[model samples]
Target: MKFTKETRNAGRGRRDLLSVAGAALATGLAGCSGALERDGDGNGNENEDGNDGDSDSGSDGDSTDAAELRETLAAADPYRMHQYGPSHVGNAGGAGPTSDVDAVWTFREGADDSHYEIGTPAVVDGTVYVPENHSVGDDGAETVVYALDGATGEIEWEWTYPRGTAFGSTVVAEGAVVLGLGGSVVALEADAGTERWRLERDFSDAVTVADGTVYAINTTYADPPTLVAIDLETGRERWTEPLADERMFWPTPPAVADGTVYQGGVELTALSTADGERLWSKDFGNAVTGPPTVTDDACYVPLGDGTVAALESDGTLRWRQSVERGGRGSGLHPVSSPAVADGTLYVTSAWRLTALDADDGAQRWTTETAGDRPPVVADGVVYASGLNVMEAYDGAEGDRLWRYETDASSSSGDKVAPVVGETAFFPSAGLHALRGADATSD
Candidate 1:
């Protein structure tokens, strides 16, 4: 079950100078309890990429349509792992919370009278699986994964871990909820929150589960990270492959789509989901900002040096577009992962949001905003979370639809992206579920 390849850096990347320091900054959250280690642009970028989750269970049977979410989420890829599924599309699809949203319920609990941050959630059959790590009594720490009723935002069951660092992502698939906790990959029964399996490692990133398999990226901190595949039914390792020969400081989780698993690091690689077979890898001369957004026809990735690149299935470059404004002293170097829905690509940079045609990478529209996390598209609206602000825009016209200002951490990419279930979930120290005042399930 050891998948290793002697793959070295394809070429010296442009950001190699800061790789060592950046990696520490990227993975720093693993050291703290509930504190997020994020690469911020004040615009939504990765949703932090792999914070997403999945489940085969039915919907909440409310205004949110789980069936519809399953359909559109599966349109390009499975809701395999986090960051809004394997395609990394960030589209909740189906019946999402529209304009004039109201808080239906909020999922929050304090440990020792202090609140912890909530990570991304995966909804299945009406339950929300979310994880959080909190400090206890100034010295102790605890990691808890709660299974909440999507309709009511009430905790139905929770599984607690002795150690923290597992708050990065919570994923539910194949009747199991999986997450990375304190350098280990843990799986629990989705309904009972009972421990199903655990695999200890040194360093673990966000996990992705697809087609009864769990893909995990782990490292020992002394070397580079590795991509590991595990059987969902059993804790047995399927295969593990080294993602980079040289270390990657802040690589996002792997995206599984179209029978291919796309991994980003110093290089962008495509692998076979069946076995750890390398399909193609390209040295982009830059670092990948987030998970690769793989669509039916092409794959898109945000580069570290502030640009977005499109690739064909064969790993060939299609087109490269610069979302970075302020080249000649504009001082704007916006970097975030790309979210694609309805053949449109959305990226948020420093103080601006840009929409582009998914085909050919032509600019569709751009608007000035304060978003920093990767944008989430659901029901044709782009949800951007920035410093003390949340704004929605028309996916096609790029017009500002509505704005909701809040005390929520502007570091939304680290806490929770826009998780649209029966309602659109936002993280503001606690998990908030919102639904449109006049919206109905389709």
Candidate 2:
């Protein structure tokens, strides 16, 4: 069904039913971290208003149990549509790969030849899921999604779709792997590489699955694009809403938290997760270049003007921070989504990674980095990818920990932010697995 601006609230009955289901699923699948400590410190205590603190901080009276937190971290899905849940915060919850890491294994597709390209991989429950594109014959290309063992870098199973292209990263949800292929969305059993369901449509961007529903944007670079909702299990269309006529140069997928879906395009729009009702809309006057990162209290959007704007849950503007990039115009501004952890917001712009206080938008620290992909935070380290190198920084102090060179070229155009689990996975020309230097002895 199509929803327009006037009839947006037509499906109140169905939306009310979905609201209950969405709430329950959200509580269960919500990322472990949300609030930043009120004192602007990395403490794990709640404030006077009952806002919880950072999960990584060891403060007194924190509700998250240590053992439970560890289990969640161990099973963390690193690339769940922009690194750890629909918020795109890039916070990995528990400890990430340490500074002392060595390449454990490198999996190169079609190593004998040179036509294969692997997209950014998703990690969940000790497995790395990746979609690969390679030439099938002379004129056709094939896309295959492969599940690799996270520890040994071995392929467990692979599902191939002939004569298609998978443009974005893979998402693991509900014990299945979902991705967009050409104009369709396909789900595969995460373990056995069996096809669960496939929905035929025009989805040109990555898919975000949360609260038992999958959110996608069906755009063909034409007017009147659509925001669609599909059943996470059956691949059935729940609702479809027409977006504004503004064309998007890049795909800004929707991020979900607390029963609300935040999407970025010509403007930042908030819609109900239950149905496609337009709750609110805000125009930043500049193109929103990346998907928003949602927390308990605020949603963060990265704009093309080197500014990160934070909004309250009701779509009110909280604060906006502009990172000065010498004299370069907005065109050169980094499009990386902001990553929040330990009460700090980490964003990359103008070849630098800047950390800001999540509460007041105060600048905490800034360090030089390369590339435009969002940084991932785990344990106490921040992982960022630059032209051809992936570097880790001290999460608390913003100190350079170590760097790993992925290719010899200075500008490899590799934008894969390292995904950390038991091991750190980096995707460039191929996938490289690294472990802590001390892991060998242990």
Q: Which ten residues in a row have the lowest lDDT in candidate 2?
A: 1-10
Judged by whole-model lDDT over C-alpha atoms, candidate 1 comes out at: 0.62
Q: Which number leads on lDDT?
A: 2
**Deviation of model 2 at 328, angstroms:** 9.3
Scored by TM-score, the top model is: 2
> Per-residue lDDT for 150-233 in model 1, tens only?
555667898887754434557778888888765678899987999999998754545677788888777535366778899988
- TM, every model: 0.77, 0.78
Q: For each candidate, how many residue pairs have backbone atoms clashing (under 3 Å)?
A: 16, 3
Clashing pairs in 2: 95-379, 96-379, 100-437
lDDT of 2 by residue, 106-185 (tens): 66523223334556788776677887666644556677788876655557898987653534557888888988766678
